[model samples]
Structure formats: C-alpha cells, structure tokens
Target: MYWPNCGKGYLGPGGLDNYGKYFNCTGGVAGYIDRAVFGNHMYKHPPCQKLYENKVYYDPEGILGTLTSILMVYLGVQAGRILNTYVNVRDKVIRWTTWGVVTGLLGGALCTFSRDNGPIPLNKQLWSLSFVLVTSGMAFVVQAFLFMIVDILRKWGGRPFFYPGMNPIILYVGHEIMRDTFPFAWKPTTETHATYLFMNLWGTFLWVAFSIFLYKRNLFLTI
Candidate 1:
C-alpha cells in the first residue's frame, strides 16, 4: 500500500529535504510574504508561527535560493575585479555606475516580464532568477551610489553605514539576540500594525546607534 502522506516519503522527488519540508510545511519566506502582502490565507502551525507546508506551492527546499546567492557572490567578485583593474578613478566610477544602471534596468525588465509572461515568477522564497536579477541589480546600484558619495566626494556622510558594514557579524548576531530584549522591544501601547511597525523602526535605529557607539570607541570585530 502506497500511502501518499507517509513520513519522509511524502517529501516527493523535488529535492525536498528536511529543511525544505520545514519551509514548505511551515510557510517559509514565501508563505509569510504572501500572507502579509497579498492577504493569502497562510496555514499557521502553533509554536512555529513563520512556517507552513503546502505541497501545491512547490520548491520547498529552496534550491533556487542557494543558486541565486551564488549569483550575488559573483556580482561582488565582478565589483572587486572592476576596482582592481581600473587605473583611473573616473574610469572606475563610470564603469561601476554604468554597470549599476544597466543591471538595475535589466532586473526591472526581467521582473516585469516574469510577472506577466514567464517561466517563473519573481519569488523571494524560490529565489527565482527574476528575483535574483532584481535584487542583485539593486545591490549594484546601491554600491555605485555609495562609491560616488564616499570615494568620489571624499565625504564622511557614509560613516554610519560603514560602521555597521565593518562589523556585520557582530551587528547581525547582536540584533537577533537582543531584538526581543528590553529597550529594543517593549510593550506596545496598542496591538496595532502601526505600533509594531514603529517598534521595528525603533529597533533599527537602536542598532544604528549602537554601531555608531562602537565606531566611536574603535571597537571593530573582524573575522
């Protein structure tokens, strides 16, 4: 007797490993975003509120997510290559800016195309190729913008952002661990979305402030 809902066997043959099952069953990134943005009815599992499994959604294991990450890394490598190879500062700035604009436009086009007529939609959970293009392109544009502001203008305006970038591991870990703790989080006056949204913004500001403090003290954690 072939039981369709049998244990691990039910994971099927689409690279649906244990982690993927967790994402699919528990309503991983895709589920949460869909629920919040599109008002989709998300199947919430008690104790673990962020995940929901629905076989109909597919790509539960996030294979594409990993692949898109590699593409992002490649973009970083290309940036490094551009910096190292370019002799003239003007050339470097122009090249990086041009690449940023091109990629950003391409990403936007791809996203639009995918939305209307596509092999796959731009899904954050699936890490679809369209999603990769959009994010990586935006990343390129942001990098170019910073390059122009800090490197070209020789301005100290980017210092705050730089502080967090310098010690990202520390900032990330600290934020995750302390996000729900006192000061970072507190009882809201009202149980409304606005209240929670303000709390989130407050948490972000606190981290930036903490990063500034660390920067002033010359306390940097480098791996």
Candidate 2:
C-alpha cells in the first residue's frame, strides 16, 4: 500500500491531467483506504470496477496478486491430482466438467452481469478471486476438451501446441525478451486494428516456428 511507485504516471481521482495525485498517498489515511479498496495503478488501465467508484486500480505484482497466485497454483495442483486419480477418460472428463462448471458459476456469482463493475470484479492485475476461479474453471474445461479429443477420440495430434508445450519456459522467456523487437512488434505506419492484429498473429507464428525448431532438435527446457 505504501509503494512509492505503485500508481506513478497514471491519472488519479483529481481527473485526467492530475497524474498520481488522487489521494494523499505517501502513508495518508485516504491513500490507505483507496489502496485497500482498489489495488495500485489507476483508472486508465483495466479490468476496472465501475460500480463503487469505477476508479479501482490494478497491481499485477502486489500483495493481492501473490495471494491469488498461490490459490491458482493450488487449483492447478488439484486439477493434476484429479487427472492422476481417474484412469477412465470418461470419468476424467465428467469430473473436470463438473469442477469447471461449479467453479465457474461460483466465480460468476461473485460479480454482476457487467464486466467492469460488481461486488467483486474479475480484475487480473489485482488477482481478484473471481478472475482466479473463472480462469481456472476455463482451464479445467479446456483440459477436458483436449484430453477427450487427443487421448480418447484420437482425432487431432496437438501439433504446434505439442512442440511449444514441451518447452513452455523457453517460449515464454523468448517471447518476453523479443516482444518489442523487430518482426514481433513495430511502430505501425497506420494505427489500425488490422495492422495490430497482423503483428500479433505474426509474432505468435514466429513463436510456433521457434518451438518447432526446438522440438526437431530434441531441445527442451524444464524445471
């Protein structure tokens, strides 16, 4: 809450021009209250909470983020345990679907119909409980779908995904390192959605290519 650089460079309650001057900040009561209610950053970035004040900020690496991440990890471990426990693919799918739907509903119940505001908004930067449950639920659902498709039906081999899945750490690190570099991202001549979409798709293709190269060479990075 007392981080000096928490919401730096972002506009605060004072209005558009007033950057980082919302509350008293620097160990003030109002600042503490604001931080407690919100997270960090400010109104500019999402996922916003438009109900209470619509000025809730987000801090991806804050205390809230750490706590929520621990929960996410625990959820992932439980999912893994479920996968290991069930030998039958049908049983696995049923369990995963049940978990996914239940958790998803629980997460959705925390928020309202509106995406931006609710009793508890799904803010990823803040690592809201809603976000954790919803995303984890989606992950379980996807896992079930993929397991059924690949393992049970044996329709499509995972292809490019299989390659990247073998070396996710390297792919993640490489993408981060080269995200702003040439070929991955660039200053567009025309700032249109098409250009932005193309750039992002191109970057993803490059990563898939790189993953394939590593796979072919029998190279993998693992913890």
In terms of lDDT, the best-performing candidate is 2
For candidate 2, what is the TM-score? 0.68
lDDT of 2: 0.68
Count clashing residue pairs per candidate: 9, 0
Alpha carbon lDDT of each predicted model: 0.61, 0.68
By summed lDDT, the worst window of 10 consecutive residues in model 2 runs over 9-18
Model 1 local distance difference test score? 0.61
- Candidate 1 regions with alpha-carbon error over 4 angstroms: 1-61, 113-119, 185-198
Error of 2 at 35 (Å): 6.9
| Residue 44 local lDDT, model 1 | 28
- Residue pairs in candidate 2 whose N, alpha carbon or C atoms collide under 3 angstroms: none
